[model samples]
Target: MTLSLTELAACFEGVIPSILCTVGADGTPNISYLSHVTRLDDEHVGLSDQFFSKTARNIRENPRAALLVVNPHDGAQYRLDLQYCETVGSGPVFERMAADLRATSAQVGMTDVMRLRGVAIHRVLGLRAVRSPLAAAPPEAWRGSALPRMAAVVDAFADRTELGEIVDAALDALEAAFRHGATMILLHDPARDCFVTLGSRGYGRTGIGADVLPGEGLIGLSGKEGRAIRVSDASRLRRFGAAVEASSEQENRTRSVALPSLPGAMSQIALPMATQGRIRGVLFLESPKRLAFSAEDEAALALIARQLAAAIALSEADAAEAAPDAPIPRRPSEVASPHIRVVHHAHDDSVFIEHDYLIKGVPGRILIHMLEAFLSAGQVDFSNREIRTDRALRLPGLKDNLETRLLLLRRRLEDKNAPIRLLRLSRGRIRLHVAGYPIVISDRKSGAQ
Candidate 1:
């Protein structure tokens, strides 16, 4: 039976490294391990050009080459006879391979070492499966159409009116429908130039308010490039949590939250939530099993991310269009017995509740504004429109993204289990629920509260 290149899908996932054999003009054969092998089409494949000087030299001298790839699912092997084609330094194929390499290398702290110079395209002349003595194992039960489950997840987004609910639904759907237990949603903060974790699941700590700079890691790189990035096997990479613990501690000293991670995650994918060219956030998932996410999974998740981005944008617009509610008289707190110390650091707009870091940047500024209003006028309710138009807030012009900021602030407060809370009363209105009498302190210098 003739086997098509499509039948070797598992081999292209990079779960197991491939081997390339090439011959020089002198007829000397050279063999090397390949970090990536991308199936451009049924007859074409693209190999990453990194740390392959000898392979490159041989490929130039001899166009004929052989590639051996193994199936990560059942240890099946296939050898492909290839003819070297042109190398691409830039293009869709090159960019895709570069992104994947960057993501994988970043996982292993080899971002500088594993730089992609170009992609060597090759034509598949023939394919031959290696004979094995043992019988092949049956495919896993979960190996089937993901369309139905993907549809259900997309449908789950239909009725979510609030940004918070939408974010939660995305994470929950990933678990319920896709069986991806470890997931997180980090929203982009343009002013701060970073992504902040607003929602997460299946982690020991929520890692809410965690900050990831653009191009920092898999999540950041996906957001920076506005594309999906998947690393099928990260077993050799240093555990992200352990590698960054010291840095996280130092960042925490300056009020930065540590990123959440699964200790032994073997596979990871970061899908960008984007709409109309602007990235809104990132949908990140990781697993303990290698090759947990496939090409189809990435495509499906990309669609879901787009839907989520659009939904978030629509929700924000709807909130912005809401008519201002009639002014309500001040309502005094029923019980203001205990006092909670709220400190606002003017330098970075970081807010802390009784010395516990809560949040910073736009969300922090918004919280301080709300707390100040409550302190002065006993005002429990506020309107989004007023917040957006408030010159003191100095929110970004025209694209304030007030709704998302409020959602972040609300979630952070709840995550911290702080004394203050922001409850959405309607599309444009919210009420501040303070459990204790608040003493607001504003500091101009960078110092401990």
Candidate 2:
């Protein structure tokens, strides 16, 4: 029986390297292992062209080539007869392949060594299954249609009006409805050119405020390319949890938060939450079982991610339309407490509450601004409109991401057990609650008692 590319989805996952065989003009055959084989369409596949000079030369001489791929689940093998089509230097396909290559290289600590030159497209002429002597693995049991569960998740997002609640609902749905226990949501910070961990579930630590650069890892690559990337067996890659632990040990000196991760995750997928041609964030999920997420699962997650992105965009729009509320007069504190030292480092806009790093970047700036207002005018209430338009804050224009930044600030304070808290009073309005008097210090030189 003939096998279609869609039926052999497991072989293209890059779990096991695919072998490419080509014949040179002198009739000399050369074989190379491919890092990735992206299925562009039903008739073509794109091979990652990085350090494949011999293969490229062979393709120039002869368009015919053979590829061998294996199904990671059942150890089933297939041979595909291919014809050289074209090499793409730049486009959506190349970018996706490049991002996937970069992520794979980072897994083995060879990110700098492996540089993608282009993606060589090949038309699949014919496909045939190779018989194996070993007994095949049993077929996986069906998990039922995910649409019903996914609909519930989407409905949950609709019910949330606040950015924080929407984020929480998405992560909660991943575990409660989809049975994906380990999940995280990282929002993109355009100013820093990185993604920040805003929400997470099923980790020992929340890792809120952690930063991940574009193309650094799976989560970063997904957001960088604005597409979904999945790994079937991650045991071959370096454990990211160890790196997080190592970074966590130096948290005091670096003031960097650790990224949450599963200790022995075998399968992982990072789905980009994109809307309006801009990537807002990434929804990352991991499981201990190999191939935990099927193609259907990825499609479902991608749909949910899109809905999440749209919901966040709508929430931001709603907040933007809300009129600034009149400031309320400050009331006397119910209890008297000792003063808490609040330090703001001007160099990076990082904030420290009594020597413990609370947050940095835009969120840090926002916190300092609110604290200054509280100290100078005894003002506790502020509006998103004020922060968005505050030239001093210098938030990104058009799509400032004010709501998420505020959420990060609020969560960071709660995580650090600080005396300061940010409470949402209404749409676009928030109140800063300080249990103890705050001693504001700026740039390590100036102080106000």
Candidate 3:
């Protein structure tokens, strides 16, 4: 039988949570509550265990394993079984797994419930589902180590694809994310200051996505606030009604198409892509399932949102490089902030980078990047040198010209007013001269506009 699992897993967007059966060193197999088993790309699955445990030790001994999951429904007897021949436990692999579990779980109404149990990561293996006798009769017809055919649809995303290519891939991923059967991605049109659905899938004869007003829908909230927002019980919410766009005839068209019935998009997620502290566009994922966005799901989508930002940045950079007339903007000592919108809640600590005193905007941004580079070098070295204008060349044209930018950059550095002056522009070379206490720039990446 088709089992729905994921601790309160969003019926549509919920992350299918599970416990993996692993053979320990003594050859005894055991299981534990796995808060982390999530999709990494389409072909692979990841496992996340908190601290070190028998399950982790089992994976360390032998990577072969099967993750078990039982939903709250299905008479408490049914579960969705995912057979993973491979596993990745520690390092960054668990990052996605842990995040997905948290988001999906949270969406299910259990916030802060995903505890990794502090299991030390043992091994990460690549898995292939071991087919069972009940591989037929549709995915819902059977369970126990069963992987649906649609899992193939997940393989569309890649870490390294052009932004244009990724846009298409993103639309597909969005459909999977929402499981709205099919979905569309609308980018915030900066020129028009409006939202427009750019791509879609899984519909016939009509598509949705007319230009929407700012701060109106989930997509609007994402672009306006620069955070990923998921909406549940869309119909019940007074703010949202039914979509007005039409679906397309092409089942796998590049542009978005409306689903036959909007596939019960009870929950939706909108992620705004940004980089280097600049907002790029929006990635809207709609789900047919109510309560689809679990906390783990939200976290997973947030990571994907970040990944999307990087992908978009890299892709656009590639495109700009390819075009003769289009100039890709890059200056020296420039660091990016993923270009997504940031929440401006007032906290005691500052999120923006600095060198003690308040340094705002790009001028402040450059100095911080420099401080980072120098401090990382160990030992404050620049001393006994006069300031010069050529420092502007280091980060081309934050000012009017190389000469003027240097003057601006140097003045900010001098104003720090610390025990010793670490940075001094001497001759054509910029210097970082400090007497004692190696000056290290704070951990921040602020920008202006």
Candidate 4:
């Protein structure tokens, strides 16, 4: 396989890292992705192998090989088959590769949970570079065909959206985003001063949905410190609390590359979610791979986080607009003081709602927040007030008709297997029948041990 020098150079600049593969003696080929590839001076091209495998061994024995690079987005993948005369490894090179590998894994959410032994290499053979569709090639082909994947996540803010539909779509998209391993949405509860795992994707057998407190584990520290944390090993991190009894809960919460240990959390970027110039919450991404998050990936994720913050703010505004308005319910002068919280026990959980303040495409935003607020505050009996009804009438679409909305809210609460009913009163009062979960106060602690 051969390519014009120009085409070969273009491949080097594409989105997907060029992979160096090696075959074990028996023919089991070990191929992994790479992030760095460059020509040492002018003759040899150097590549990193933080994702240590048998690629080096295979290259050492056969000297015949292939290189693959592709666009990360929806672009065509490209391959190069060539020969390498020698293979090499240096202490610094190994260290650098390992670092890059860990960073890349963190950004994309890949956790191998394997012992990373070391990094190796493949020395390029004679000057016979190759490219795709190689037969007829201009020694100097112009660049354009295969380029690096460029993706930017935008948090769209708008006045109103079809919330139920958008949430349904977003949930599906979120699942796809975390198809590889444990993907979660870490929401900031200013009241609690901690981050909670609201949604999870691809979790392992053990229950990971449990909460974590700030400075309690790896995730917690990131939330508390408001910065990214990296660990090279997990067993040694003192911050990881005692072992959980759950069978799936490993003694070592995360493989260490830095310091703290959070369950299923290693090499994480605790990107804070903020809007209106304030840090409202955080987005904690964990990868079992050491140094999982890369610079480019971090940049992308940071941008996504910014978009998320904007989206949440927009969703909140939209939600406000949707609140009952046909007949404005008398605003209750007394909402149980934000500081007072008590747990009323029922055989079920509290009302669960996703209130992204800024995501515009989601319709029925404001009404939902109010529903959530009522549900969140339900356990404390509203004393037969007319707040709920009055507010429903005031809302635009409700026409003071909160029966349907309440019914839907009730259905959702029941679907979650919650035994408690957060009841609404005459105007806009809300209360709960069974024990309620402790309302998160801005100053309270959050998450599991």
Candidate 5:
């Protein structure tokens, strides 16, 4: 009997690199390695097009292709007879596959070299399980482990009044109940167009306050594309060029260091926290073992992401209501020290403090505005609503995540050991602390139009 595609779902998740066999127009067989085969449905799978020039050429010339996939759980093999149908150069499928491929390439030190040209969709005409003497029994499909208590755990999220409590509870449940090790939650910073690490579990340091640009690393790409990325052997891909491109090496050595990845990570999954067609952040989990997470784990995390997204939205709204209109009393300023020059490059939104890179983009603009406001009016405390309405910030017309941007900016300033600092007074109100450093702002001219 022919096997249903659902029966071989595990093999399609890129647990084991799939082997694709295609015939050239001249009829010579060509084989290529496929890192990602996303299941569109029972009859279709999407393959990421990267380093598949020959495979693409052959498949277009000869529509028939064969794929061999192995189940990571039990080493069982499956063969799929597929027909090359079409290629998607854009949209959700392309973005998802590209993000996965980018993460896969980063693990193997080919980050900058690999680029996803498109996603090739194939029609699976036949699927057959390969009988192997070495095959082992599959792991138990359902573990009454966290599934039973998941409903209660998810419901508890709505009860969380504070964002910190919600984050802590979610991470706590993932570790104590779901058995996830090394997990982190990164909130989105629309102003900066990046994901900033908020909290983490199972790492030596929280890596909190670290910012990752979307489409840079695995976490960044997931957040950027609003997709989930899972890699079985994460350490094997180490190019990390996209991540490094965010900061200058000289700056990392002398000034604030660059953000880091999860320590001792072997396998990892980055899932975007999205709900109501809005992306809030990204959820990342890592482990030191290969194939550490399964489809079930992914499903569970997706549910959690949904719950967290709604909770976060509600919390932010509540915080906005509670925020005060006027700035809090400014703390006594210390004696003014030497002049500190803050340069704002309007071209890229890059900000430099005394030639040391502080932050760029929305956060930089926010800092500039704040410093200007302080210089003009001595304003200290501020609220998310105030920043969101600031005409000078020029925040995107879309739903602005002003709060997360503030968090990212605060963390970055702390990392740089700048004379000015921001303190969170409440969910929405923040108190700014400025040392006696006289601040000077410069608007640098840009070459770009």
Candidate 6:
């Protein structure tokens, strides 16, 4: 079969190191190792500039170079004849390379040493397979055109009525349309300036309510920079300060404190969701095999994220209504079982339950607010409008994510096995089931209440 550099896109995902052979002015050869290489297009590739002083000098004197890249999945190798194009010191290419290098550095514990100076773009003159006895495995099956699937996914969003249902529909469409193995959706927390996982699938740990600050990890970096972040070889980069705190009920609860990725994940792509010029959240997709996503996947998912963001924005207030009248049990009938001490630190919006940290940021503040309401009014059912209009929330954005924060707080409480429980009564109404745990609320500055 005829060979093309673009056909070997999997080999250029920067999962495995590549070799660069350059000719010096005197005809001597210099070889350098490349930590990262990305396919710029069908005819070009971008190589990360690291400690390649000699290779750079050789390339300058003689613009001819040979690149040897290997497919990490199948051990397939190819040699490409390259003609030096030019160096890109800034722009999108440089920024993506820098972000990826930071992930690589952290994987090898070289965050302080590795620095990206520029990206050396190269035009592929030709490509040929290296002779070997081991036969290369067949290439992965392509998902074909995403247009038809994208249409279906978008249509699914149009059919959903409730906000939570829309979130579920978005995830279902992603998995069904793209064939992505693991998928998750995170909501941006404006008050805390962080992203929290609200829903996820295809993970051992759902990581719901897990918080990611800007630049913390891949998901965090994506939300922080308001751009897409794609990484193959996710195993190494997965734990770079990325952990999901599992509920204490799980046997491996200790491991959950960190952010989580799909188990045995080799590739991941994070796309930021934006609506009306503001980033709302991020959509993360992962696969167990390497190079699971391509440029098409990235572009398609970005478009999907944009559409979903608008849907989410429109649905955020779908829950704003008066509390529904139902046969709600009286608080006095439900006798308290245990006393759970709760602390709210206003300084950082942190919450601790029974001396164990439960949640922080806006969600934490919301939890405290709920406890205060329960204590004062013996109220069990609360509506979205009530929470949104509450003077205590001080929600700091054009869009109030009261419902989303409630989703997060509920998940955190469930994971921690806290006595307090949040039960959804209807679209905009939630009933707090505080059985066996009487909450004692106290401010960070003042004494107990």
**Candidate lDDT values, in order:** 0.84, 0.85, 0.44, 0.41, 0.74, 0.77
Off by over 4 Å in 5: 1-5, 18-68, 78-157, 162-169, 203-214, 239-257, 325-357, 365-379, 384-398, 413-420, 434-449
Worst 10 residues of 3 by lDDT: 342-351
Evaluate residue 52 in candidate 2 and report its C-alpha lDDT on the 0 to 100 scale: 63
Q: Cα miss at 53, model 2 (Å)?
A: 6.5
Quote each prediction's TM-score: 0.93, 0.87, 0.36, 0.39, 0.69, 0.84
What's the residue-level lDDT of 440 in candidate 2? Answer: 82
Candidate 2, position 89, lDDT: 91
Q: Point to the candidate with the largest lDDT.
A: 2
What's the candidate order when arranged by decreasing TM-score? 1, 2, 6, 5, 4, 3
Better of 3 and 6 by TM-score: 6
Per-residue C-alpha lDDT of model 1 across residues 1-449, encoded as one tens digit per residue: 99999999889988889999999999999999986899999999999877368878898888999999999888898999999889899989998898888887777778788878899999999999988898777666676777877898889877988788888887888888777659988888889888888889988788887878888788888899888988878888764555555243455486877787787888888999999889999999988888888888889889988998899999999889784667645676554869998889888888888877888888899888988888877888888888888899889778777888898889878877787899888888899999888988887533545
lDDT of 2: 0.85
lDDT of 2 by residue, 272-339 (tens): 99998889899899988888898889999999999999999888889887845665446544334688
Candidate with more favorable, higher TM-score: 3 or 4: 4
Q: Model 2 compared with the native: what TM-score? A: 0.87
**Where does the lowest 10-residue lDDT sum fall in candidate 5?**
239-248
Q: lDDT of model 3 at residue 209?
A: 29
Candidate 6: tens digits of C-alpha lDDT, residues 164-189: 78888888887888777989899888
| Top-down lDDT ranking | 2, 1, 6, 5, 3, 4
Compare candidates 2 and 6 on lDDT and give the better one: 2
Q: Which runs of model 6 end up more than 4 angstroms from their true locations?
A: 1-4, 71-76, 99-113, 148-156, 172-180, 235-238, 242-257, 320-346, 353-356, 444-449
lDDT of 4 at 94: 58
